[model samples]
Target: MEKILVVDDDLGIQKQLKWSFAGYEVIFAEDRASAIAQLRRFEPKVVTLDLGLPPDPANATEGMATLEEILELAPQTKVIVVTGNNDKKNALRAINLGAYDFYQKPIDSDTIQILVSRAMNLFNLEMENRHLAAVAPSMDKIIGQSESILAASRKAERIAQTDISTLLLGESGTGKEVFARSIHEHSLRKDKAFVAINCASIPENLLESELFGYEKGAFTGANKTTPGKIETAQNGTLFLDEIGDMPIGLQAKMLRFLQERVIERVGGRSEIPVDIRVICATHRDIPGMVAEQTFREDLYYRIGEISILIPPLRERNNDVVLLARTFLAQYNEEFKTKIKGFSEGAIKAMSQHKWPGNIRELQNKLKSAVIMAEGTHIQAEDLNLTFNNDALSIDTLNLREVREHAESRAIRNAYQIAERNMSRTAELLGVTRPTLYSLIDKYHMDDIKTG
Candidate 1:
């Protein structure tokens, strides 16, 4: 049976509701304190909040405070604010502050019951939608809701419909492979294999043979004819990561395979036809490499028929917090921890981070923090950021970049100057303790002396 919490000052009205809504196990509260107490204890999915309570039954002061506290603690619970007689002003304010709905009335039993039923139905529907979204595949794995990421996602889908050779460009750990797999999932070749190889991870001598299979006795250790990634990925998609690292000599061979959908086993002349689509990704500056006569311009254009540049974490506003929350939820489930969300200071702190390692870095921080967070909310101290100086060298001239670097350096210096005294550090900088605390997040000075 569904439970309902009824909060009102008058005993006559409360008693009337208890009998009127006999279908539900209704609980009663005469003041804001008892109402909130019942709310936390019961975890009721539905609440009939009154805008008139004992402390300030005249005005909606106490009632409004109760409403705010209820929503803050349990945002998922539907709060239907019961407004005063002809008090439309406070009623509208309640709705704006995330109340499920506002009901103004002399409290007709049937009408209020119907309203409560409507809120419950909506709650059930939303819960279903959330469950479906969590299990959905592909780009669903890409967590940010920022417009920048959504735009890139839409573009990736458009490219997926066709078999054009695509190139994913982004800094390391921005989820290049995740986007690649999303393309494969929605593409015509969804059932077949999606093979991937990193050019940087494998030795140059073995990379050529790794992509193009060798015949038995072709090499000293070749005991049997083993197919390479391209052949292994026949009728599927072959993802060549770090494509810029392929030797200049081998680039011509790769171009030949792309230009004609065929390959020759290393020591054999049999023209093996392969019906496979090729996708490549590289963080290295291929165009610059082409100008320097290192990377072949011809091969560059072939693999980049459709190019998608993944926006870095810092460039995607609001995405940092979005990704952080997503990672927090994921870690909570994986670690069997019940950490709720980020602190206000933590959100601001995460927002300003440069995230040199991008999504991978953010994910790592949260995974460790969820395990370490002692409180219900993961605070700035829990994230323990470590600034990577290598990312700062990219654009030292930009004022924002320079300022961010300077601030981090100053904070580190200030903490040391004050002999690890956080209060003294704030006083020395002539800012309040709270302001200094937020600055610690802005700079991600996690390891700095904060005693």
Candidate 2:
């Protein structure tokens, strides 16, 4: 049930509209103060507002004030104005003030309904798109040129052309979500909504309603009928982040929706058709989860039609310097600093560090360095990546050998610090469990095993 606030002084018009819009939850406000109070309380997505109010019934002043107030309170709300036929100038002004649309009053139910329905649909669509974009990875802010990142970019471009579900698999802070949005922008459905939801962020009980939506009275707090993320993403892309955290029960429903391209509201009987392309990302071993029966096999197959593995920053040669320079320029402008670039020693330290937290960690370090560095050049000390005299003397000869030694040492340290907890060890090392398992395989470290 979409909630609509009808603000008009005419009692007869209000009564007729209230009864007619049986499909909606209608709230009425007869005066400016009452209407504003209702607006603050209800926060309706679509409002039918009369430009003539009690204090200034013959003029548009009071109505315009209400319109401005509504906009300030909820910038996203769609307020449709109702004005007299002769008040064309005022109606135009209302539109400029951000009214969704206007209806010249001699109130006809059919016409009003048409206008209201359109406004409601558009409002829902916009809201859904915003949600999608929020969840999907956006690449607009990411700056990089490493071979690994470039390869991932190429893959993302190709994946965007098809409507196939893509799974971005990587460790945390590797910019998996950024690739997801690049896919959206490059895809054919670029104009449509790009909806994103994080399985890990939302609570289990509310997750289903957030994804599948609910009809009025579907749940304790559900006061109106609403389209879920899936419905909103119709003809668009839906990005699900940290998908490994989705509950087992909801996984089944999501799998069903993926298979059938339809969903039923949590408490609704009707199946709503949806036309959405799904993209999922996680720092978990989904295949392992499927084998363990923690995640449904069917959903795994559906979401991973194509899987793209994002290489960690440490693995992407030369990308560290490239990204650091980019971030340096960005934060310099952001922080209003005169820092030119990194010192040669700072660059060396950045290249040599393991980058356990990957790109995100590097970004934070650079941001801090830019803010704290007093001189034009950022030094290794400013970046907090100190080079111990003994560690620095280790021969730079045999680069691959050096990397293997670093990887082994980091794994061993992480395991010992985590008390042999594989999950905690993997997290400390800034690698996904699967990646950690691979390391365990490579290094033959069975002694460090922990469930």
Candidate 3:
């Protein structure tokens, strides 16, 4: 049921309006204090506020105070002010203060009811639109409007229309899965399933079977015929995450599947034709892997037909704060907390630190902060960011050197938090596990023990 609050010092007008809007669960507040109390308690979506309340019934001060408090408490709430005759100036002021609409006194029940209902309808529609947009597949889910991410998304959208294999190359936590899903959603195969699998998660010996399935008794533990991930993804998309970790032996098989659009199950001689679009992602340097003979050159060529490189979180200016706000809102709804938003220091720390772990790291940190935060706003200390001190330090060399230093610190902190579990660390940092491993290799931080 929609709740509405009517705040007026006039008992007769309140009674008339209360009985007029009998359909709604109406709340009454005769004074500013009680009005605010009712607001915080009821959290009404619509409010009919009279600008004449106790302590200032002759003035608009109390009423304006109530209006500001209501907006600050719930900015989304729609408030319609009821003013006295010839009170156009105060009505306009109330509107400027964020009231939805205003009505002149003398209380036409029919007219005021229409205004309240309209406000309710508008509020409901906006809420529904927000809910729908959240579930809808759009670039909005990418969560950043930074120049780099926008440019990457624009390229990704164009690549989505093509049927050719497209590889997403990015450090872990950069939302490679989100990019792949976005591609699938925007592509012709939007209605089909999007199957995602981590190539590195599966063991070397069992990875092939997991990809191409196995016939009964194919291996000692293979007692039943099972379809592999590739076959299961028929008529849809197969997102090969962490493709760099795929064993060299299976890389040839994957390349063949891409070439011929066919696969043969383990211990089965019959060839099974599969129709699917392939989108692979990796944080590794495929060229380096190819040179090292660790990843197949043919497969690399096939998957890299089109490549989208996702920039690290630190490089995307202002994206850290954007993503943090988005995550705070998400977790607030999930946890049913009234966390208004992040504090100034939190935003500063987020903006200054090198997000070595990327979006994923930001998400985890925010989730923790939201849950652990004592007040309505999340502070920098709540994030437990190790770079907080460095961000405040004035002793810095060149800009590039400072950036590198911050990046190194963020990476080290993320590694410690994940206890050096590359997969978990990758998750914390918002990169793929393989990407985390690659970072470990890049930074030569493998000697760091899992905390």
Q: 91-195 in candidate 2: lDDT tens per residue?
A: 768876778767766666654665677678868866875674576544444455567776776677667779888999999999887788888887889999999
Report residue 329 deviation for candidate 3 (angstroms): 1.2
Candidate 3 residue lDDT tens string, 1-451: 7899999988899899998898999999998889889998999999999997779788899999999998998999999898876676797689767787777766766557767776898799668757856765465557665788888888887778789889999999999999999999888888988999999898899888989999999889888999999999998999999999988777788888889999999999999999899999999999998999988888889998989889999899777886787788789889987666665456667878787888888999999999998754676778886435455446656664465456556777887787767667667778654444433422334234422
Lowest-sum lDDT 10-residue window in model 3: 441-450
TM-score, candidate 3, is 0.62
lDDT of each: 0.80, 0.81, 0.81
How do all the candidates rank in terms of lDDT, highest first? Answer: 2, 3, 1
Over 1-451, each residue of candidate 1 has an lDDT whose tens digit, in order, gives 7788999978888998898778788998888889889988887878998898886688888888999999999898898888754676787678667787666656666557656876777677667757856654346666666788888887887888689999999899998998888898888998999999998898889998999999999989999998999999999999999898889999999999999989988877798999998889999888999999999999999999989999999899778986787788788889888775775446656876889999999998899999998755676778885333324555358664466556656666777899889888888887666556545533434455333
The parts of candidate 3 lying over 4 Å away from their true place are 1-138, 386-451
Q: Candidate 2: where is the Cα deviation over 4 Å?
A: 1-145, 388-451
C-alpha RMSD (angstroms) for model 2: 27.6
Native-to-model Cα distance after best TM-score fit, residue 277 in candidate 3, in Å: 0.7
Instruction: Output candidate 1 Cα RMSD.
Output: 13.2
